[model samples]
Structure formats: structure tokens, C-alpha cells
Target chain A: MAKILIVDDDEDFVSAVNLLLKSNGFDVAIANSRQEGMEIFDKDNPDLVLLDVMMDEPDDGFVMAQSLKKKAKNIPILMLTNVGQVTGMDFDKDSEMVPVDDFEQKPIMPNILLEKINQLLGK
Target chain B: MQIIDRQKVNEQIRDLKKKYGDDRSALMPILQDLQEIYEYLPDVVMQETAHSLGIHPVEVEGVASFYSFLRTKEKQGKYVIRLCRTISCDLAGKSNVARQLENEMGIKFGETTKDGKFTLEYTNCLGMCDRGPALMINDRLFAKVDPEKASQIIADCRRDFLKSDFPKVVPSDVKKAGPILDHDLKPAEAIKKALSMSRSEIINTIRESGLKGRGGAGFPTAVKWQLAGAAKGKNKYVVCNADEGEPGTFKDRMLLYEHTDFLLDGMTIGAYAIGASKGFIYLRGEYLYMKKYLEEALENRRSEHLLGKNILGKDGFNFDIRIRMGAGAYVCGEETALIESLEGYRGEPRNRPPFPVDTGFQGNPTIVNNVETFIDSALIIVKGSEWFNIHGTEKSKGMKIFSISGDCERPGIYEFPFGIKVSELLKEVGGEDTKAVQIGGASGHCISQKDFNRTIAFEDIGSGGSIIVFGPDTDMLQVARNFLEFFVEESCGQCTPCRDGNPKLLGGIEMLENGRCSFTYLNELKKLCETIQNASKCGLGQSSPNAFLSIVDNFKPEILGRVPEAD
Candidate 1:
């Protein structure tokens, strides 16, 4: 089983994602804020990360993605956010500002999320 | 006989440090209190303050010299009379009042009377542009002062019988009120409703309302709240930018008075959404008269458990607010500069990228919204986005409060929706025959007659809600000169283009007045305006040349080829 870390402040969304990952045979760990997310990543060493952009800070997910890339280049980051909808600030994956393996909007369809995860994890 | 009690002064300084805290941020209030005691800040007193605050004496001196309100070398007269010298007042014959004051005082402007009874000085806008030739004597405001009234005021001040001449609170004339202004929303009701909703839900509601900043900038308010909420800080802050020093802008003065509760409600709601435990209302020194009224309002909120810790029975949710006074620096109206003033530093704009949301006061996340913006958001919380959104256009949602002045007959506060046209506004305000209109303040565009059809929206001629109408007889060149002079005086002088280029533009206007300006040189000056706009570090500098450029471009036929006057 590929271990996955779900980092978001929205409890309901986090809970739903946690169940989806677990039932699909992926082990899941949860962290609510950017600081907590980093600590959990170090401790758990998850295979993949489910990141949120606006948590305790607006760009926490992007900052975390950069840090994660620096720490473990092999591990993939899948950004799940409502930042574009919320802020109206158009952004996409770029190596410098928004560094991530793949980006998807929040309330992501379960099958699409699993397919993206499998592709990043080389399933 | 000015007596200096060294021991007593030292003890008082120690007490002030305790009252305000021992950090560098406490320097401004402590100095203000000391100035109140001794009339002027003596070197010995400033040195003692430096020692108490644990900052250097030169650092204290730097701050004292920066603000016009803080005096150092000499004692101010018992009455420090600051007469408004900005555009609207200038148009309202402030010079006549200025001459009358000088004749009555037996001293020129900036000089204190020998007996220390009175001092005359020129200040920027006093937020009374509608009633021009207004002057502030100590903490009291006197508006519509004619030559006769000016002399009488001087006599009254001398006899110490000016008590009955002024009202306790200044009255604002609201000529027209829209749904935003005349709503039946009570005090703290929005806050009560905000408390019921989740934090994200509150932010989402604001985002849905399309509420941009009302402080002239029109930046989206929801983005600011969301960013501040997500920002990593031990403490976060929600600041009410009550520094309404924009030359022709005074709607905030009315909002602070008329919509006091709604303003407080919005601020409390902002604090809750951003997770800010503390907030500050950075009130301008010009609006010193409104301070006590606001302080009392804050006290009411605290007593009712609407403001202070664990508000309304919510555990671990605690928030409080304080009022900080700006010492007559117009640039302090800028968000970062206001934060600097709140931190006891000179009101200079800081470089961007690490914006206020990510890093602000005391290196914490902070949101500084205009007074009207806060009230609008709070109203959104109570009434929902649709109630606020039904009126305005697509991009610019909700109504805006305008402080209309200059040649307009009905000069007062008017609330209009976002997409109202200039011509429509003129007809409503009885300024249909007006030659041009200076939309926004000194930093905004001076619109011509042809562009009256342009709507007041983010997509068009956006305003911070200051409308100055120009009559047919009005001198466009003089109008440009007045705005340039305002920028020259009010610029923080941190950047070269703003500090140097503004005076250069003012000199060019003088040449135009004398008809000595050449066509090639005129074009050169126009380029300089663009350079100043592009090169300056902050908004003040960038927008300083706006009025001048607009007038030069719009009224070319009238401005060019002037006959040489008799020297």
C-alpha cells in the first residue's frame, strides 16, 4: 500500500478524502495546518501528499510543495485546492511559484483523483 | 514661566512605558503624552523617553521630527490653529481666511504669539472639504470661517470664551443615502450573525458579495481576509484605516460617526475571520475630535461582551481592539505606512511582496480595511451577498460613499452604486453645469466634460469616493498646481521621483501660469509625470502626478500659449 498524507484545514473534505484513500488500499495520515503538515511528512514519510493551498495561510500548500520537493524529490505532491475559485487569482503549476507534480481543484471526483495518484505513484 | 520638574517627568515617563508597553511601538503615544505635558518636546524629556523605551535618543528625535504634530525646539502657543490648505479649501478662499488670521494674530503662519497664546499653521485636508476654510483650534473644529468669523474666532480664543462657539461633535450632511447608508442594521447584529457562521463561510459570503476595498484601491476584501486567516502568526490584527487624509475625501468622517456601530461590527467580524486576537483603529490626528466618540463606542462593545475576550460565550475565541492616533501625515493613509506609524516609526511605505497578509504589524498577519469596507462586509454578513450585490455592476459590487466638494452646490456625503456615471452624479448633486470634475483626490484623475459619460467603476474612472467639481470659471492650471503642491507637502520623501519630481511639476505649472512654458518643454514635463508614475516605490508617489497629467492632457487648448504677464 502506498502511504498518503492529507493536509487541509477543511475537516469534512479531509475526512471524505481520508476514507476514499483508505478504502482504495492507500494508508492515510492527516494534518490540519502547514506547520503540522511538515512535521507529519517528516515523521510518516508518506509515498504521496494531498495538499491544500489555503489553510492557516493562503499559499501554505505551494510553500509546502516546494519544501517537499527539496526534501524528497521522488515523492509526488497532488495539490487539491479552491484557491482559484476563492481568490480569483489565476495560478498553475510552475517550477518556481507553484511547484507540484499535478494540480486539481477541490471537491475532486474520486476516480479522477485515484487515476492521478496512480500515474504519479507509477502504478 | 515654564517649569521643568525632572523627577516628576521621569516618573510619568516610566508610567507611560508601563501603560503602552516597553516595546519600540510605544514610542509615539509616549511622546504625544509628553508633548501634552510640556507643550513642546524638550531634548531632556526626549532623552528620558528614549531611556524608558530603551531606544536611542536620536531614534526618538527622528520620529518627533517626522510628524508635523510633534514639536521639539520650542513651545507651541496655547492654541495651535491648523487651517486647511488643500484644493477644496483653496477654492473656498482659504487664502483670504489665511490673510485674516495672520492680521489678527500679529504673527505670520508657522509662528507662535510672543505671549504663547496662539500659533497659526497650514495643514492638509481636515476631512472638512465640503465646508472649506475650516480650521482646528487645539482639538475643536470650526468650519465656514469667513473674514469676520476668523477675526471673531481669534478674539474668542484670546478671551478664552470659545467654549460655546463649537459643537461637541462635528455634524456631517448626508445629502443622499442609499441602501448601504440608510439600512436599519443595529449595532453588533452583523457580528452576532458572523459568530453563527463558520470562518470559511464568512469569507465565502464576502467573496460572493464582490466587495472590494472602499479605500480608493478597490482591492478585493475577501482575498485579504482569507490570506490573513491562513497566514502564520502568533497574533493577527484587523486595522480600521480611519486616516481619511485624502484631500477631498471626508466620507470616512461621516461613517465613523453615523455608522459607528456597523464599523465596529465589521471590525469584530474581520477579527474573527482572520483569527486576530487584537486590532487597531489607526485614527488620523486631523479627526482628533472623533476619537473620544469612537473610544466610547469601543467601550460599549467591551461591556456588552461584543469586543473583548471569549466574545458572546464562545470559548477560546478572544479579540480586542485599540485606537492609535496618526500625527498629521497624509501618507500614513497607505496600509504599510499606517502599520509603520502604528509601530512608532516614520510614516514611510515599505517595499512589497511580503505584503501585510503574510507579514504585518509586529511581524504578524494583519488586514487593514477602509472604514466603509468593514461596514459593507459586516452588512454582507447580516443581509447576505445578494442584498449588497443587487445594486452594483459585475466587477464593482455594492454602493460607495462619496465626499463631494468644490463647486458643487450640495456639497456633502452621497451614497451611490458602483457603476453610476459622472454626468448622472453631477445632475443628482446639482453640478450639471460643472466644467470638469476631479474624481478621487489629489492622487485621482481630473476628469473633463467629454468623459462625464464614463462610469465610476473599477473598469472605468475608479474613485476612492472624493468628487471635486470644477465650475466654468475655475482655473484648470491652478487646480493642477494645488494638487501638485499637496503631493509635494504630503509625500513621505522616501523616493526621489515623488520628493523631487513633484516640486518640479509644481514649478512647471508656475511657468504655464506665466505663459513662459515652451511646447517642447511641456512635452518633457509630461514625460516626467509618466516617469514619476512608473519609478516611485509606493502608491503615493505613483499617483502623485495623476491630477496634473489629467488636467494637462484634458485642457490643452486653455493651457497652451499664454501671454507674458507684467513682472
Candidate 2:
């Protein structure tokens, strides 16, 4: 089983995703802010990470992705954010700036999210 | 009129319409150019402009009358001498210079000399607080003007030989420097970095930096960019609010002169992020000395392919910036009022529901950021978010450039982190014996020594970087009176609360000065301040009573039942 780390400020969303990832037979770890996410990333070292675009600030998730990639270059980051819906902004993954493996808007179907996560883990 | 030339007037109006645009927003620059040619706006020329722009003649008159700089009733002198009368200049012996100027010109402040050589006027904050007793003769700024210097300046104007003795770009007296001041990013480096990223990526980089608007209002900069970028609009605008009219604020004036390339890069980056094709720097008429320099910088950027079509060779990313001259209205510092002024209307703020982000500047998505905010955003694009946000407090998250003046031993610009304590700052500026500190300009609070422990942050006491310190001998009542009078002159009269309420507050201060106010009436006046804050239509009106309320709150014991001054 692959371990996944969830870093988002939305606690209820984190809990729901945690349950979904755990029931799918993956180990789950969670952190709320950028600092906490970094500390947990160093501590837990999850195989894949689920991140949010807007945490304490508007683009915390993207900033954290750059940091995480610097720490572990091959670790997959699945950016799940409603920033497009929230601010009506359209964004996609970029190699240098975003550095995420896959991007999806929020309210995704549970099965698709699971399939995306497993595919990133190469299961 | 002085022999109106019909063909010449028609020709000039046509050329102005072609240079600026046929759009209603082109009204201000057109009128400004015409005013330059006619010495003042003549009735016939205004009529020609009105017919050309398809606006009502009455509306044109309304706009001309609203701004203090515009002259419609009579012709102005060739040299317009505007003396700074705001508190900083007042404390620096501005009245003596005024008296000397009046004597030299043989005219009062609001009069033109008989020979039509000079027009004398008093203006609010020429953005020369650190070098006070400053005056502007036409577009040339003369700082530290004493009575003797005033005589020489008048003599120079008479000889028609007033050469710009000062340097082309006046350097800011930066007492203490930090990262933003020390940013060494070259010209267009940030623009190239931004061009490589997507629109949302550009915004996300700024958002990640946690930069807030440095214009005293702590609105998040990234959020403003994001909203403006996402708003439904075929045409969008990024306006740099360069109207540095606050009483003791002079940092923007320095930034415009010193960091010319940085400001242009920041503005270009903002235009790219928001998909804006056109931009404007609504510079205050006080800083008219810096206009040609800024225009030169814009032209240089265009030549370097950092501003014009396909910026840095990026396809379909065409953007250019123009300089708009503000005709001396302090209220136009407010964004909506700036927009109204941009539209060639009275510089009065509009009601917000469709805010500037959604419907602004001719009903398109427009984002107006402060000069400092734009510069900071551009620097953040190159330096990364962690480098910028690491200095200040968690919420405030950046170093703020302070224009420190008044009662301080070392009065100049200082870049201190946002969460610095008042006492710490006073010590740094050799103003430890400070009695009161006006954190913002006239619209900010007058905090006494008791609040010295408080930090300067958005979560604590946020400021737009105008730190005017008052010593022990300074009169607190007089400070309150000066700020109230500023509001009274600056109020747009669009809303009743600000129009009527401010004069009443000034009257109350006068009563306090004459030792005639009762506690009950003073309480009533406080309530009126609250009413003005609650009922005013815009931010300027709401903040009019801030200095008074803060003074009364902080110095209640000294202010109440105070002995009257000797007549």
C-alpha cells in the first residue's frame, strides 16, 4: 500500500479525503498549513501528496509544491483545488512553477480521484 | 475671452482627440493639454472640446471647477507658484515662505499678479515632507525654501531664468535600507520571469508571496490581481495610483524617481497577469517634476521590447503604459474617485457594488495598485515568495518603506519590517522623546506614548508608511485641528455626512481651542465622528475624523477642561 499525505486548510475536506484514501488501502497523513505540511512531509515522507491551492494565502499549495519538489524531486503531487471555481481563475500544471503530476478541480468523483491517485503511484 | 481663434481652437481640439481617444476617459488629458496651451481653460475652448468629445458643456465646466489646478474663470500667470500647506510643511515654517512669496509676487495666495507673470496658490502635500517649506514653481520643485530663497526664486522667475537646479531624479533620503530598497533585480528581469509563466502562475507566485497593498489599506495584492484576471472583460486596465497626497507621505515621490525601471516592470507584469493591454500611472500634479523622467523610462522599456507589442517576444501580449496627470485633488487618492477623474468627471468617489475589479474605468475590469505594491510584486516574481515574506510578521509579511518626518532628529525614508514597535522605530529615528505619532497621514490615528508597545502591522496598527512624529512641545489640539481642516478642504461634498460633518468637527476643535466647549457637546461631536464614519459614501469621508477621535481618546485628560490659549 502507498502512503498519501493530505495538506489543506479545509479540515472537513481533509477528513473526507483521509477516509477515502484510507479505505482505498493507502496510509494517510495530514497537515493544515504550509509549515506543518513541510514538517509532516519530512517526518512521514508519504509516497504521494494531495495539496490545495489556497491555504493560509491564495497560492500556498503551488508554493509548497515547489518546496516539496526541491526536497524530493520524484514525489508525486496531486493538486486538487477549487481555485478556478473560487476565483474564476483558469490554471494548469507547469513543469517549473506548478510541478504537479496531475491537477483536478474540487468536487471530483471519488472513484476518479482514487483512480488518479493509484495511477500516480503506478499501481 | 482674449480673442478666441476659432480655426486654431478646432484644430487643437481635433489633434487632442486624436492623441488621447474619442472615449470619455480621454477627457482629462485633453483638458490638461488645452489648459497648458490656453494658460487656463477658456469658455470657448471648453465649448469646442465639449462638442468634440460629445459631452455636455455643463459637465465640462463641472469637471474644470472641481479640480483646484484647473482654471476656467480667468487666465493664470505663466508661472504658477503652489506652496505646500499641509502639516509637515506648516511645522517647517511654511507660513514665513508664504508671506515672503506674497510680498514678492504682490498678490495673495489665490491671486495672479497684475503682470500675469506668477500665480500663487497653497496646495496639500507636494510629497516633499522630509524637505519641507517646499514649493513648486510651474513644474519645478524647490525644497527647503526660506524667505531669502523665496525672494531669489521670485527674482529668478521674473528674469524667466528659473533653471532646474536640482538633479533630474531626486534621490530619497533613505536613512535605513532593507530588501525592497536593496532589490538589485535588473530592468525587465521580473518581466521576463513573469512572461515565462502562465497568467494564473503569475498571480499564484504573487499570492504565494503574501503581499498586501502598501497604500495603508491592507487589501491582499494577489487577490486583487486574481479577481481582475478572472473578471469578464474584453478590455482590462492596470492603473498605478501615484497620487501621493497624504500630508506627511513622500515615499511614492521618491519611488517614482529612484526605482523607475522597477516600477515599470511591476506594472508590465501586472498587465500581463490580468490580460490588460493598456495601463496608466495617475501621477499627482505635485510630482509633475518626475513626469518627463517616467515618460522616458516608458519609452526606453518600449524600445527594449519590455512594454510594447509582444513584450519580450511573447505572442499576443501587447501592452503599453501612459502617464495621466492628476490636477491636485486629495480625494482622488481613493480608487473610485481616481476612476471618476480618469473619466474627465469631478474627482468624487462612486458607490461600490460593481467594484473596480468587476466594472471599472469605462465599465471594464481594472486593478489599481499602489506604486509600492506594484514594485514589490515585480520583485517578488524574481526573488520568490519565501524571500519576500520572511521579513515581516506572519500576517503583514513584508518590509514597509516609511516616510518618517516631524519632530524626529533623523527625518527621512526608512524601510523597517511591518511588525516593528513604535518605541523601537522612534529610537531608530532619534525620536525617542516623541509625544505622539501619526502613523498614517491626516486620515490615520494620533497614538500617544501609552501605545508605544503596539507594533506597526495590519494585525496591529497598519500604516501606509507616513510616520509623522510629534514631540512633547507639540500641541495635540492643534494637531487635531490641522487634520480636520485638511478633511474639510479635501471632502468631495458628494455625501452629506462628510460635507456637513467635517466643518462641524473643525468648529468643535475651534471651540476647544477657545476654551468654550462643554463635556456634553464634546461627546456629541464624538458621536458625530462615528456618524461620519458610518454614513459617508466613501473611504475619504469615513477616515476624515480618525485623527480627532484618536487624539480625544488618547489625550482625554489633557484635552478636556484645558486652559484656553493666550490671545
TM-score of 1: 0.85
Give one digit per residue, the lDDT tens place, for model 1 in B36-136: 98899998898988887788899999999999999997999999999999889999999999999999988999999999999889999999999988999
The per-candidate count of clashes, in order, stands at 3, 0
TM-score of chain B of each: 0.98, 0.97
Error of 2 at B406 (Å): 0.9
- Could you tell me the lDDT of residue B204 within candidate 2? 76
Could you give candidate 2's per-residue lDDT for residues B1-567 as a string of tens digits? 389897899999889889898977888898889999999999898888889888898989999899998999999999999999978888888989999999887899899988889999998888889998889888888888899999998888889989764758666799998999986788889988998888777887788788999998888998788767756678999999999888899999888888878888899999998889999999998887788988998888888888889888899999999999999999999999999998888999988766787578887889999999999998999999989999899899989999999988999999999899999999999998999999999998899999999999999998999999998988899889889888999999999999999999999998898888888788899999999999998889999999999999999877885634333
Off by over 4 Å in 2: A1-123, B165-167, B561-567
List lDDT for all candidates, in order. 0.88, 0.88
- For candidate 1, what is the recovered fraction of reference interface contacts? 0.05
